[model samples]
Target: MSEPIRVCVTGAAGQIAYSLLYMIANGDVFGREQKVILTLLDIEPMMGVLEGVVMELSDCAFTLLTQVIPTADPAVAFKDVSVAFLVGAMPRRQGMERKDLLSANVKIFKVQGEALNTYAKKDVKVLVVGNPANTNALICSHYAPTIPKENFTAMTRLDQNRARAQIAQRVGTDISNVQNIIIWGNHSATQFPDVANGTANGKAITDLVDTSYLQSEFIETVQKRGAAVIAARKMSSAMSAAKAAADHVRDWWLGTTGTFVSMGVLSDGSYNIPKDIVFSFPVEIQNKQWKIVQGLNIDEFARGKLDITTKELLEEKEEAMAICNAN
Candidate 1:
């Protein structure tokens, strides 16, 4: 049998993790033949809840399951883990300002980052799934100096999946028909879900759908889809977010087969995006590494949209810098 892959998940008792844990155990992220040992973490108060989660995982009788460890200590949870999902963060509550939210989460990520630096495998692949994920990832990366910055990514696959589904619906086709859709910038309202360079059933998306709707309604819908889910479901998106998180790590671990997927990775000055900012861009994964898809022409409209999102990320970095750098 192959050696077991150590996978760590934070916020193990939360909604997204509730949906995500089973998928990971079932070999949805790692391959079916791969054995996995999960190290799950949460706050001390949530440790009992995490224990219940472990009990459920035990009941599943997954053939590839090796073991499950539940703990409140980040160091213990992260130790020797090859893949770490930094899925826990402070959620935005009613009446909480943006700065307050940033401040709260920055501290959480800072501690986790330090623990990861001290404990996780040198090549650990970390994906931040929590809200304001791009900035949270930035803060985490800033503290984990031992881990390669490129190994740290934020989840933009959710946004990309939403964009792909929207285009597929507009074109009256399955989502499998849409290819190369890009979710650029932060995973916020300013995110640019571009379909201009994408295709639906081997034809350019712009040729298949109304350009006006693509630019306006389609963009708005994808940006606000999370809020819409919250309003209708009385909670934030759990299943889709969980699935997206799985897909994000799966594609990064396996290769993307020369396809473009959206990932919020540290900027290397590509498209003039500032270096070290965790920004989403069109990328192709190969050899377990991501390279930004280069030389794609950005029209004036796209440029304007990118600028707005970039400005927001920059402001977020500045707002959280004091907290992020304190470690």
Candidate 2:
């Protein structure tokens, strides 16, 4: 048999890690044909939890899983890694400033980036799933100057999937029928889920549903879905988030040649988004890299919303830069 593909996940003791590890071991993300060796990375305090997770993986008796290694050090965890998921982050507490959150994450990402640059395989692909994912991804890409910018992306696929599911429910149709829905701009509250271009079973979403209702209520629903889940369950979103992260990376590496999906990628000034800032946009993955779906004609309304989301990304990028420079 050939060598197993190495997959490294940071923040392995967190809730999402719990959901993600099983799926990976079962070949949910990388496929059954691909044998995997899992590397779980976490902080020193969480190393014990990671060990427990590894024990569970061993119990599953998954033949496709070659090995599981848990570590607190990025250098060791990322060594020869084929894929890296940056999932551990400092969650923003109530009353904490956004600047503080950004700064804290920057410190973490900077170290990871340097480690990845020095240790990971040349073909390693990175997905940032932590909060302020776009900005965090930018920091990593910037620090790893030799890695291609297209190799670093943040997870906005969750937001995209959320929008699709909400639209499907509203239309009384299955999610598989939904297409062309775009998650524009930041992955945060400012994300613009453009159903204007979306279709359900070849029917325009706007034509089937009330455009005004979608613009007002539907958008808010998709944006606040995370909060709603937290309110109901008294916990952060983990399972769905993990699933989305898996989908994001799977589609990226596996290729979305004909289909478009949303991802936060380093901007090349597409749609006037500032260069180097990781912003969400409709993209198609080909040739092992993400290429923004360019040349789409944006109406006035879409343009306005897109600008709002891009502005937030730009502000966050500036904040991170300022904090890094000051320190």
Regions more than 4 Å wrong, model 2: none
What are the per-residue Cα lDDT tens digits for candidate 2 across 1-327? Answer: 457989999999999989998888888887778899998999999877778898899999997899888998889899999999899998999999999999999999999999999999978999999998999999888778878888899999999999999889889999999997999888888898998778998899989999788888888998888899999999988999999999998888778856679999888889888888888889988766778888787889888888898889889999999877776
Cα lDDT tens digits for candidate 1, 140-203? 9888999999999999999999999988888889999899999999989899999889999999
The residue ranges of model 1 lying beyond 4 angstroms of the native Cα positions read none
Question: lDDT winner among the candidates?
Answer: 1
Q: Which ten residues in a row have the lowest lDDT in candidate 1?
A: 318-327
Sequence-dependent TM-score of model 2: 0.97
Q: Give the distance in Å from residue 21's predicted Cα in candidate 2 to where it truly belongs.
A: 1.0
Q: Residue 128's C-alpha lDDT in candidate 1?
A: 97
- What TM-score does prediction 1 earn? 0.98
